[model samples]
Target chain A: MKSILRLSVNGKPREDAVADNTLLIDYLRDALGLTGTKQGCDGGECGACTVLVDSRPRLACSTLAHSVAGSEIETIEGLSHAGNLSRLQRAFHEHLGTQCGFCTPGMIMAAEALLRSNPHPQRAQIKAALAGNLCRCTGYVKIIESVAAASATTELSA
Target chain B: MAALSDFRLLRPASAAEAVRLRGEYPASRFIAGGTDLLPNMRRGLVTADAVIDLGRIAELSELRVVDDRLHIGAGVTLATLAADPVARARLPALAQAAAAVAGPTHRAAATLGGNLCLDTRCMYYNQSEPWRDAIDNCMKIAGDTCRVATKSPRCWAAFSGDVAPALLVLGAEVQILGPQGMRNLPLSEFYRDDGMAWLSLAPGELLLSVRVPLADGWLSAYEKLQIRGAIDFPLTGVAVALRRTGDLIGELRIACTGVSSRPELIGGLDALAGKTLDDAALSGIDRQIRRGTQPMETTVISVAYRRRATPVLAKRLAKRLWAASA
Candidate 1:
């Protein structure tokens, strides 16, 4: 069953024919060619497929593409503007938040949602927001620092 | 990673239409958040000919008070429930339990109805299709023997959900819509001890909303024990609701999940009323919980650990609620 899904991706409205059973991650990675969103554990165990649906972080692998019709879906690729990395991405890069970079996109997306809502989040709040996302490489010290650094930079700019 | 099995998806606009579609496709299953169902479907633990998505139903997303009782629609997401001011002020246990489920992202999508109707999970049953096939499916699936308890005819899959215990302690009632009509059942009666048939919902029935009587002067709290603080299901989850009458116990209710096939309200607590929650009373309550809960080898955690920890967790919650009343 294929239906036209009308949604906003990366601030652009898209109306694509998607299968009823096609997961959001597949639709982004395969259909839209947004390979920035990596699929770590296809099952909902790992947060490698985290994306922001209507400004809230959701597991793309667990969500159906058609289910999020008329919503704003943002992937990791949406973060950069004019080829420059977003604040969180730059923080991750500078703070050594990525090793293999498998979980970086989902981690940054989850943190992106967190920082948007709570611009000055504490370490515990940052940790709580990204608890679902797992990073095998950084041991979370750099990841936490990355999020904290992004928020601190935001504070400095404000 | 395994792919999801092909199935038709139907989105209904209303609860009545959802029921009609369910009847139209008798082999269909209701999906609210798809957090639990999608994972299970991907693992081949469950399959439906069609999935009747309840996401678009407007009525199921409402959360309001009716006649002094909080009418929480089944479709209300856990994240919304956790952050709701009314839920936090009135039924803090439910809010805390909702916050405690899975992780922040999962809670953003998982619904109250789905959590209430979560499938019973077992170590052997929750595995991949190839893994389960290698050992021959368990009683929950197609096999003849129960994997957790080989000789037992019934499956021992534990109900590891975190929300049911909180609802049970609050004396909640569920509004169920079926082909016959609408009916209400006590939340306690909504579960069965049998793992394979945990929920008491009849075929073609949908849980509409949960009605919880507002606890005016009650101090409630929920505690969960899991391997991790997030994502993992509870090894033992306890919810305690207590109302004090000036240094004496006015009312005390305790409920637990992940200790058995169904989340249950701990029994034999009527004697504790009008008595101060002293050390002796707390110890007595601990004994009662230990006697009531029978943790099996359903999860990766040891039965002995769960059995020992259930009482400690329950007692800690009870004491905290009791102390908070002061």
Candidate 2:
């Protein structure tokens, strides 16, 4: 039941033979040794396993590894370039968005998708995009602030 | 943490081929987005020896308006359907319901077909396998007794799909393909009251598309009562469609979910025809809904709370539709 899967991960081509039931999160964390994507609440309820598949945010835990073959998959490990944090990541840190740090990776990915589609999203829009992700700590005040700050930074850069 | 059982994955090029593969492997399950099925598989609620992925089939992902009806392929993702211009302009109720399902990331992967045919859920039935086994199981699984209503002879798992009630209220029809051939039926006919056999889909049968007719001069609204704004199934879902002329009601259809095993299309609304939806008439409809629905003790909240919320949600949604039509 093992099939060869060929996909682009973190802007690099990856090919591996995987079981039919291999989840995308498992393939990323175990087979590829990219542990930046944390797995919490293996069910689709929690957004801890969020990843970008074909430039869209999706729950990695509920996604099958074989179904997304040949798609560009982005993970937390790919957020920084040349060892410097991405704009969204820097904004998250500066705004004190991480508390306990378990939900940061997924939170950033969800925001990344929102910002990619809407450069200067309003507060309600940012909240709607991150509605699926759960952060028990920080009470979501600073998380929203971080996304708003990231949008402002993008405007300045532009 | 649960893990999926071993299974062979099959990718068919077309719907006909998918049916053929399904016929060849009777124990296989068709997976489009895997948002609902995979988690159930992991929890040992659904057992399948093979998975037939419908994502690669191009024809099944089509969403178009033909003549006067909107034809949405079963494989169309919920996110795509919610954001489609035609759906938003023509079927706003369906668009809102689809947008309200699950969360943003799950909406990106969950398909309309899967949401329409979502599994029945219960507090006891949806638990992990070991947890269910420890409690001696329920009628949804292996046990003979119904935990929700100990003396009842059937399973009372709640059908919590947010999209089906809206589709039902819009007077939609489903296109089904199977080993016998293809046939189209009203969306209401596709559901059965029994939770164990909620869907009327035969073995090896595949749902092809959902066809919703465009109705002129009709306005609709949907409301869902749940604990969270996102990522939670509705405890009570209400949908109302009203066609009015000035202050008089021309046509009205009310439907609800999460109150029973299948979405209930409320009857007895014809009594208020040609009459304005006044406070008295609204209270009458609310009482009718309360008397008709039987909320079981299956979810986190108490049965009384869910039963009480049903009529409130219906009245609120009815008022919204009336205001919009006015």
Candidate 3:
């Protein structure tokens, strides 16, 4: 059975008639073409498929489309407006937080969620927040530094 | 779109609706975080006709502390528990277990209910069924006679649920809701100590809530021995909950996980009812802890290694408890 699912993805209200078993990642990748949410492991182990559902980063590959009805969705592509990189995105570039960038989208999205709520997070706090998103290339040091560097300025702003 | 077909999903708005839907579709299962379920499905260990998404059920996502008992709903995420100040301050062992489960992102989506219902794990058993068939199937999933315990009739796979020992030592109670209303009992009582029927929840019964008695003057600690400090399942895990009265130990509960078929609790702590946790007492406690564990050839860790490290963890836990109270 299929039902219509309505939600605002990346701040825009959208609706789609989804089948009973359609995953939210398929809706984002195949239907809406929001390919930024990578589907890695298709299970929840690798955070490569992470996307924000109601401001919390979740495994899009594992989340069903029908369950996200009426919730706010955010993807890595939505992090910036007017073609400008968000601060965390900029920090990733500055700190060399990417290698092949396979896990970049999920890592950045997870970091953005952390920075959104906690602008000034400690080193331990930053490490804790990004634990779900695994980065095989940078060994996590650059990723941690990117968040910490962003946090320094983020704290001063707030 | 002309009604897509991939995997069937149903979002039940309420608990009643979810249970009723579960009744209709015997092949359907509730989706809490999908960390465990989705992985098993992708690996083909589990194939479902339909999946009931439990996110819409508001009653399951609550965390309430009332009258010295903390009530945690099934939907409450590990991230929420790890980040909650009340949990850290009041239920330190649980918070430690929650923080250490998987990694941060998993802690965000993975719920208390999901962790509690984590599939019984083993390195040999977690592989694909086809992969198992190649090996003639281990005792856990497809075939009979535990290769882990080749002489054993029952599955020798581990009960590696991270929070089980933490909740067990804290005097936690599990709430089970079914068609007949609800029932609550000590969390330890919910275990069958058999890998096949690990959780005691009956058909159509949802593990609704966990009630942990508040520790006022009590000091607790949780320690896990794992290959990696982050994201790896514990080779052996320990949780210590104690109440010290002046120089005397008022009460104590020691529990361990990832060491047996279930969260193994070595009771009869009344012996240490008034004894102080000094160097001598800790050494004595370590000996008692060694007597408690009966490690087997299940998990990734060697039985000899886990058995050796069990008392070491007990000594560390004893010292931490001493310092926590100090």
List candidate 2 segments past 4 Å from native: A155-158
TM-score of each: 0.98, 0.98, 0.92
Model 1 residue A6 CA deviation (Å) reads 1.8
Q: Which rank order by lDDT, best down to worst?
A: 1, 2, 3
Write one digit per residue (lDDT tens) for candidate 2, span A50-109. 999988999999999999999999999998887778888899899998889899999999
- Model 1: CAPRI class: medium
Model 1: lDDT of residue B11: 89
lDDT of each: 0.91, 0.91, 0.81
Report clash pairs, candidate 1. Answer: none
Report the Cα interface RMSD of each model, rounded to 1 decimal: 1.0, 0.6, 4.3
Docking class of 2: high
Cα-based lDDT at residue B85, candidate 1: 93
Clashes of 1: 0
Q: Score the docking of each candidate (DockQ).
A: 0.79, 0.91, 0.54
What is the TM-score of chain A, computed separately for every candidate? 0.95, 0.96, 0.94
Best by DockQ: 2
The better-scoring model by lDDT among 2 and 3 is 2
- Which residue pairs come into collision in candidate 2? none
